[model samples]
Target chain A: MEASIRTGEKETGRKKVLISALLFMGLGHLLHLKQYLKGLFYAACEVLLLVFLPKIITGIGNLRTLGEAQPHLPIRERANSMFMLIDGIILLAVIFIFIIIYIISVRSALAAYDQTSSAGAKKTKQGLNKAFPILGLAPGVGLVVFFVIVPLIFSASVAFTNYSSPGHIPPNNTVDWVGFDNFVTLFGGDATWAGALGRVALWTVVWAALATATCYFGGMLMAVVLKESNLRIAPLFRMVFILPYAVPSVISMLVWQNLLNGTFGTLNRTLRTLGLISSPIPWLGDPWLAKFMVVLINLWAGFPYFMLLTLGSMTAIAQDIYEAALIDGANKFQVFRKVTFPIVLYQTAPLIIMSFTHNINNFGAIFFLTGGGPMVKDSTLTSAGGTDILVTWIYKLTVNLLKYNYASVLAVMIFVVLAPLAIINLRRTRSFREGEL
Target chain B: MQPKTTKVNIYTIIVLLFLTVSSLLVLYPLVYVVSAAFSPGNSIASLNIIPFGDGTTFKHFDHLFKNTNYLIWFRNTFVIAAATSICTVFIASLSAYVFSRFRFTLKKPMMMAMLILQIFPSFVGMVAIYVLLLRIGGLDTLWGLVLVYLAGNTPYNTWMVKSYLDTIPRSLDEAAIIDGASHFTTYLRIILPVAKPILIFLAIASFTAPWMDFIFPKLVLRSAHKQTLALGLFSFVTDKKNEFTNFAAGSLLVALPFILFFLASQKLLIESLGFSTVKE
Candidate 1:
């Protein structure tokens, strides 16, 4: 960067060599570009990172080892491998971000140097205007990195570890990297784990599909019906229907759980009193029945939002479409099939897919309603039941059974399966496709 | 306008009949909850089939407030929910403004990342969050819970609000800047006030999310004193306890205001969803 002008073209070549050789991030800016503040900030970051280099290295090393096994120490005094793993994750994330900053600094400095056709004629000022986006984004991005990304990395790391309960909980015993053992166990290595996983995974797909389809079509039907009915009290009906969606899901699920309780429940009591049946039907007490009921109850709680959404999209369709279809000698059903339904579907397909992913992870519907109950006939999976989707299964495994490794595997699976669907949804969005406003 | 049909068609009649039955099904549990909250006995079995036919009492309400940690739970949940909402809006709006108005090196990738981040289930990181909270002393602390909520709050809400903000012409900000307004000032006085509808939707959404979230609170908050509405109320109705009436009473207290909030904001919520979806 401090290369004397032996020749103008040759000087540029020499400066590039010196800057890359020195590996000083801001040297080009300091010596050639004369952007002092920019230079200072870049140099400061490099120095700060250098200051913390050993700690960062130790973090990566700790993540690799989890923690030193202290068999001689008592349980309470032992190293917590979980804590070490998380700390390592945080450090790694910090390093990753620092790398991005480093690259930006070096690139900007080089770009500025290259633009200096005349020396010191165009020094880049670090204006507040240029700093606005970075300043504005810092706090939110910081929260996300620590709170979201670090935790995500930790969970993903747990999937590769032996970090479950009883035998593997930290402080009692240090967790070791198992590396796809859990994945293998669930995927096919262990019969019981594999069978339970296959059944649950299949049911998860079925549940999400059924839940999404039923709610969508059901809500669509209601919206169309309400639109066609021309009923004066339609607004009242809309309000009533919206109750399920408006009420908090936990409360709604709890109320439904009690109402559907096998014994002493109002529904069964009424049925019994009316001599509808001699035996109380095990609405939630039977496995298949519980699966059926979960979808049905979800339909009740979910439809209104779709109904509203459908209605909104419906309004956006110009009145002329319906009139044109009618003029073309189409019946009401034909008109809807040809025009209304397709339009609404086109407009709301993203949301419908979103709902599918939502249902896939809809823990409350299964968790609070049946608590993933009415265990399957041959299920060796103590944490998962017939109604349990992957998300709820993960929850039970984590909270109840302390099967953190298996739970994280399910979490990873859910991410793999669902993230693509979400990405597809994102791709379909106009804002995303167009790239920016 | 065409004159109203003097006679009801069979299709209309059939639809009405169907709506009537479904309405009853929808109303039944709601009616039951209201009845259970007021019924004299602690057990649902003792209540009459017809709502309030068994004669109502205030004992469950009295029990919920007096005998339980209902008030403390309410305070904890309210604090957490409010903080999450306010912080989510502030953080999301600020970043959203940058995303909407600025063209920068990392802008596209950051926006895309925001969109993608919204889709990953936050609880997928349950073990990590638990460990992280443990390390940071956030476990059982309301601020800790708020921090977790705020983290999850950023990505989607930022994208949603950014899209909303994008619709507002940059001409206003430019006009203000031309009039000697700073970027932050233009955002504070010009953009935010104009973007009230979306901001309100974001606030209400983030607020209501934590109220019904049983899982994270269950993981984070261990003490009864730090329990949220979902956690504390859940305790009364777990397998070991059968305080259904108290749960019902407590839920009604939570649900009634929530229902009102939803009703009042239903249009906004629907409109926001509609806007986002129909953008294509």
Candidate 2:
């Protein structure tokens, strides 16, 4: 926001405007002997951007060639160009932002000149006095820039290259710009990447949907059972049930992973001791069982969250709605369906959507519990664990298999898939709306 | 009007029984894990889901304290968590203060960016982060981990803290500023104290995150000495030797603080959860 300080109540003369238009953008402010700090700030910005242009242009030039011409060049030179290309993109974004600020600053300076020249006597401080908000924001913005922004741009750029498998990593074998070859490989049904992606995509969707739906309805049902009935200790039961959620998810998932661990697991041991089973089940080693166990563990870890959420809202439902329904002779089920459930659903729908998208990227459920495994051996696919969602697949591709480019492609794809959800979630949520801050 | 003629039905009995059975089922794994921690044996090879099965021992815990770098990992996790918490609370509250008080051009877009920028699962950036940290010589360190935690916790934490601040009336700010107090001083002396509850919650949340985080630390910190409590305990079970009892002991130690905190903050937890759904 631009704050213009006025000294008087009259407009500035054309001479100051001409000086500002001709000498420099903000020179008119100094010509009027008004808004000196604002004018100086604008002047400094123009000079800085002007000075900074060449490096950005150099980066852009390097980005254009992008080392393709010098393919036969040494690894060091090739990687240098790649660095230049990526850094160029980030620089361009920065320059774009700077341009926006420059325009705002210059506009504010001109406006300040007009006002201050007219007012003539009583002047107020402007430019630096209001920089406090920005100063407050500086640390968080700096952190976000380095951690989230830079890494994101870097990852998105990787999807355009061939930085996969053994030979293409940097230094040992300089990663190169492949120009959407990775995307083509991923989506073009190449036996290696496509088969795994296809299976993984199906399982990912199924897992996300099943995990979200089951947890939501499961929690809703549990809450209904506990709350609808004349239960005195419902809060006690609810707290006990939510123990799974209150516990750190990583710990719970790991505990469950071992609890269902086929041979030495308590599940098997207890079942056997009870004479319910003669042999151990391959709870986590079989593909189907592992997938099932993944969902089961997620539900155990996830439902209590929904239960707690639904129960809280449930209690807040106005008694009038229930009374009105019951006065019309509606049965308990009808009263719930028409009144109670809808109100609760309205309250929880956004959360359910958020939970669905959250479950889509749920790394811990599969990562800690199953590690996206019992490996899918149907094809020669490398890292497609039986239960690997898009997220964990991205993980396995990067950490375990060194398929950085392929993983980056999957990462971007996951973004494309989830962006809509994010947008909707933001649009619907209280946090992202107007007047929120 | 009360339905005083109500009779107990099978549905009620079934629901009651269902709740109890499900409660036990849910508690089953937790009970087993706790039992294993105290049970004498390492593996569930000989133990049942009961306390002091075959005479439990504190030997595994003693070994963890004496042999392994468990204490160091605990210290490391605490340092990282506390640093992350304090830094996140301070930084986020500062930003939140700015956001809550000031109106600006980029404010809307910045909020949107905060929301959408986090859409991509963070693991996507893992390799890039790995490379970035490697290039900057930030790998295998706690400071780098803390930095990442701060970045990761910023968006919603800022929003949350801001919302908390938004509830404080603007009249206070105006009065303080009119009383010759700068915006910065008013924020420090008045707004922050008013928003103490949310700040505390945000700090505790940020603290607990790194204490239990597995992925980022697992990637960034490679050395055994640099491993977090999460990576350390995960390796306890994931190792070829499979130190199950030790993993249990480590996990119990790891969970005790959080569970205690959760219990202490139960009202705040429920209140926050309630606010999220009903806030609309």
Candidate 3:
């Protein structure tokens, strides 16, 4: 009798699983498991999906073909592939959300059948209680999907299309897929485009490196000086040092722009009054000088942050370690080199890399200070300037030049380069360790 | 900690001298901006060698209030920043609480997704965001800017809050649940109070982001009535316009309060940054 009952239970569980999997998301729970509330919720999802099915299909189809050309119609009345592409991506996001719900429904059915837990009001309460996390996460995840993910997908899609201005703008024209063409043009196909890409990419890397290093070392120097000094008014100086960082960067950059303006800026005016130079210097008007000034100005705006960070990390270093180093016959400089520097670097290595990435996209520092101006001799062809890094160049391309395809290609390259660094960063953070929390 | 010395050492003298020179380098522009704001002219050209700029006047402030859309821009930016702050805090904290306290199958993948999202250059999607907002009637609207900021804020902030929340003892949560508290009630009454520091940091960070940001507002908002402080003040110094004094006055007004806030909250901000970024 026991064997027979076990067999019957096994067959019933299989039946419920099959029903939930094959027929509908909630049929097993509704018909056999007595989980009426949970089943109804799942069933409602299915109903919603069915209602939107035709729209979803067409949206995805439009995404694939972009859109059919309607050349006979007026420009204002013609089909817009860009709109269709965006709408299709949004629809795809919705479908993914539905699929996630469907999986959850199936899993819940399996669990309920396995446990043979017949439902009541109390069981429904437990079910809702178990779903608290999902409910909490739903709104944020939903917004990210639509706003972040959809936009991201749409932009990435642009890399594979011919979506520039003049001839290909929507209504006047329709975009079509041209796989690898933008990338090829950037890499080697066109001499000007290829050269622009090489120069911008090289400058971007060099700029990130120099920016990260200068701020890091400059801040470290100030932090060490402050720690070692016994100045009477050090607190006052510390506050002063932080002023550059505290003031809004936009304000600071604009101020610097005015101060360094070759013609009428206060810096040049003050210098001339003091008899420093016969003529005004083009601090930002000359390409090489502009690049140098960019790094220097970025140092001014950026170092205080690292200074504060270093100070915080230094304070956390143990007094015993310093005492031990001193006891080992090491002088102050030796102690710093051997113990303090290593400790601080270990603590802040991740942040240093993070800052590197930040500087790579430091659009404001370049854009506001120079407006990516004093254009290089050949940079006008690509609409980028001497000081334009990859990001600012991308900005110029999309916003100023209407070169969507090329901008998207650069954006993709940024992703390809940065994703691995982010993963490495994730691995470094102990809090991000899998199953740790 | 060093032995008290009556004599000032050469090392200390050098350090102080270096600091003074650097501080002046940092201070000159600020002083110049302030002097320009009050100077009796509209250009930086007339200013003297001293940053005091001949004399002081309130004309720029007067002009800022009466002749321009400064107040409207202020109101618009204030609204967008406040909305973004409140929504980011609530939504990020809610999701963080789940990631902290709950164990679901998708939890790891979701966490990983958040990190990967940061790898993408956010503004690359500017075209899509523009179109999306246009379709939803968010263009030229403050709320549309808020949505974009809130979306951008969610991923990294969720991780930061989650890291902070992890430091809060799980036993307290278990005790609440044992006392028959629902998950949300525990989150509201127990977790939020303890997580106040990180949340404050997040709030301040998000609040200040819109003030410094010049790019997105320029893209999303077109109407003169809807411009932000950054965009409006930027207009004063652009190639087409040169109201440098007006720009200076406006910027000083914005920067003064921010500087004060940063000074007051320095410790809280630094500590919170350390908490979120550093592992034990």
Clashing pairs in model 1?
A: none
lDDT digits (tens) for residues A51-142 of candidate 3 = 98898888888889988788999888888999999998888888878888888777777766766633322334477777899999988898
Each candidate's B-chain TM-score, in sequence, is: 0.93, 0.90, 0.95
Best-to-worst ranking by TM-score: 3, 1, 2
Candidate 3 wrong stretches, greater than 4 Å: A1-4, A117-127, A432-437, B1-8
Better TM-score candidate (2, 3): 3
User: Which numbered prediction scores highest in lDDT against the true structure?
Assistant: 3
iRMSD per prediction, in order: 1.9, 2.4, 1.7
Taking the tens digit of each residue's C-alpha lDDT, what string does model 1 give over A230-308? 8888877888888999889999998889888999778898898899989998899999888899999999999998999
The TM-score values for the models, in the order shown, are: 0.94, 0.90, 0.97
Question: Candidate 2: where is the Cα deviation over 4 Å?
Answer: A1-58, A61-86, A126-128, A326-331, A378-380, A429-437, B1-6, B9-12, B46-51, B163-169
Order the numbered candidates by DockQ, best leading: 3, 1, 2
Angstrom error of the Cα, residue A23, model 2: value is 6.9
CAPRI accuracy category, model 1: medium
Q: How does chain A of every candidate compare to the true chain A by TM-score? A: 0.92, 0.86, 0.95
Instruction: Tell me the tens digit of each residue's lDDT in model 2 across A72-160.
Output: 66756654544654566667667766766656555555565555556755566554556788779879887887788878888898898
